[model samples]
Target: MATRKVKRLYRSDVRQARRLLRGHTRKTPVFHTDILGPRGPVPVTLKLEYLQHGGTFKVRGCLNALLQTRGDKTGVVLASAGNAGIAAALASALRGMSCTVVVPESASHTKVAAMWSHGAEVLWHGTTYAEAHKYARQLAAERGAMPLHAYDLPEIVTGAGVVGLEIEEQVRGRPPVLVAVGGGGLVAGVAVALGLRGRVIGVEPEGAPTLHAALAAGHPVDVDVSSVASDALGANRIGDIAMEVAQRYGVRSLLVSDDAIVMAREYLWREFRIVVEPAGATAVAAIQSGAYVPAPGERPVIVLCGANTDLATL
Candidate 1:
């Protein structure tokens, strides 16, 4: 058997992204609270990352990738389910570069409108995101533009890792962190930053089990996406970087039911008066559903990763 070459993410890379991201992102606030566990009450911290610009953390990666294109005077192209497209468009607009976004026809109307509002030339491709991604790459090649990926890029993953660095400084004691997993970008980056200090748990909707599927298969495998959190966490397969990072750093995985995701989203509104989309609340769902039972000594941090929900749906 031969070992595969796995590209690793480094803390130094995270620091560089942090340097590049200065003045471009917000240090989203965190709230401390306790949740009931089977043993007793377990302390938990909620990282309100949904308040990030563009109402999602996608802006960090998009901005970092855009800023890195220093001398290359080229347009940008993107294929996103929702938030990433909006982030790419906004970043390009801020940099005064042209951007084109290709999205699935099934994407949220509000999300599509947001990309257009951010000055992206939005195009509707096929219904599935895979279809849109292929088309977006073709268009990028045709225009000689840079293609900004939602995940699976060193720049994008490193930018997302900055979130973990921020968490470490804001909260003491190297707490176990729970982050929602979509394409494995955010969790992978966070794991690289956190290292072995504490456990990094990736939570996902049972319907969209990309990380779980990859871990089980020992490689990235396409899975069916049909979760309430699908719009944000609907990467059909986890990226190679995420799978490798998980294997190297011992990142844990948890699956929560779709019903639990809905309930958790509602609970955030009723109990904490916090507004977040389904994907944002998915990490909390692990706790609320008892899918992840915290040890008495473990204080887990839940990252609310997105807030691009249509109020009508809420």
Candidate 2:
């Protein structure tokens, strides 16, 4: 496996990245809310990233990586559960680079179709994202293609930090917590951007507690992969870089039930008119299930990460 020392992104890195993404991605809204307030006395702000380009915040990092690798039209290859593939394909299309995406057999058809629509060659591999990633690496090496890791690169993390940067500016003051966790990229980036400014509580599906398992083992360790949010949050193990950044920033991880994710999805659609995949709603699950209580009068922020879901399921 490839290994590299990953640095925590500074405020200047995020500031420079924003300039790079000016016309490409939106500064998604951070809406202060009381909608889920009946359950607790704390106010909440939802960072609506589902509204971002390519239907998720993945575009920020995808575009950043592509831009950094500019002048290489030989194209890039990547593996993703869904959203990352869509983001990479869209970025490739915009840059006129040939792109291929390896996705797990378990990925939603809607996401697969979106990749095709963006002119990306989609290859289905094993039953999970990790398997697809393994194959993608082999294919990239064989084709002399650049590999764009979904969560393990510094550029990707720096790009994702933009979400926290936008939220910090939009929210005015620090929220008590910002909830999100996956293969650890999103939370890691957000934590770095929000470090010492506020607390960031990471929420993962109990079925796919990559970060939790990593923390317990004192390093990135592979965990069982079974979760409704598996397509998006599922990684056999947390990325080594993400783990380092997250641990250094004091990020705490929490687990939520699959039932909570379903309810969170429904809540977002019914109340806020937002459609999100299970992973995207994980942060909301933390709030809905009372997994993390807010301090009185303190604000809580949930990063609504993505919305690439099959409409029929909604």
Candidate 3:
């Protein structure tokens, strides 16, 4: 199997992202969170991407990759904790291509069910997304399938950049900070989109601080995975491309706790009727737990990136 070519994100990539996601994704509402704010009611905006197709922002990248490989009937293979698998499956089904997804044992049943519903073959392996990814790569080589990485590929970053572009358009005025990070794709693309407009804060679960660890060591390095948000934000190491974009663009990384994620999840659901998974709520968790504090009257935008959790578990 050929090694996939990974490209660095740029201004042009952001432009393409907007064009690709124009009609597919919801211009998800950005609303204030009154429940978790400063003493003077610090206004916050939530980019509700949970309403996005395939139940997360993963669809944007998945569809972008499919568009690039339109003539490849050999199909594609991927491994995801949940959201990416569902997105890939849905995109492949819509494009009339075959897809096989390897998912970790820890993947939520709801996500696995959604993938199967989209007519993709689902394989369960190992105990985490990274391990499943290894197996998926092997399988793709055996099957002559193109491998689509969840967060490390250029097309994926370009597609995810749409989120940042949408946020800029939706917010009207400049926001002080945009908070989000996971495997570095979302935040890296977003950082490029912001592009000197505002600061981008990359929030990682304390248990799995891949980007944080990378920053500290001055290079990408493996980190332990033990966070509640591990499934979604659980890349052991940041991608070289993502790290390059992040460093070049001046993105900052912060750590947030699992308890904070739980609180943010419940807070959003209780206040705004928005249900998000642990990984999706990490940005909001940063603000809610005071891990990321905004300056006086500084408006911050928190991306609610996914909603793939089982409601029953909530």
Q: Pick the candidate with the highest lDDT.
A: 1
Q: Per-candidate TM vs. native?
A: 0.95, 0.95, 0.93
lDDT of each: 0.87, 0.82, 0.80
- Candidate 3, number of clashes: 0
Question: Taking the tens digit of each residue's C-alpha lDDT, what string does model 1 give over 1-314?
Answer: 00256567788888899999999999899999976544556689999899999998888988888888966766999888998998889889989999898888888888888888988898999987888899999999988899878888888899999999999998988888999999998999999988877579999999999888888877788999999888888789887888888888888889999999998898888878888999999998898888998776777899999888888776
Candidate 1 lDDT (Cα, whole model)? 0.87
Ranking according to lDDT, highest score first:
1, 2, 3
Sorted by TM-score, highest first, which candidate order results? 1, 2, 3
Q: Which stretches of candidate 3 lie over 4 Å from their true place?
A: 1-6, 38-40
**Of the pair 1 and 2, which is ahead by lDDT?**
1
Q: Give stretches of model 1 more than 4 Å off.
A: 1-6, 35-42
For residue 296, give model 3's deviation from the true position in Å.
1.4
Candidate 2 per-residue lDDT, tens place, 1-314, comes to 11346665775776677778889889998887764633754468889998998888889988988887855457889999888899999999987788899998888888899999999999999997888999999999999888999988877877888888888788867775555666777787787777766677889999999888888877888889888888788788888777886677777888999999999899889987888898888988887788877777777888889888887887
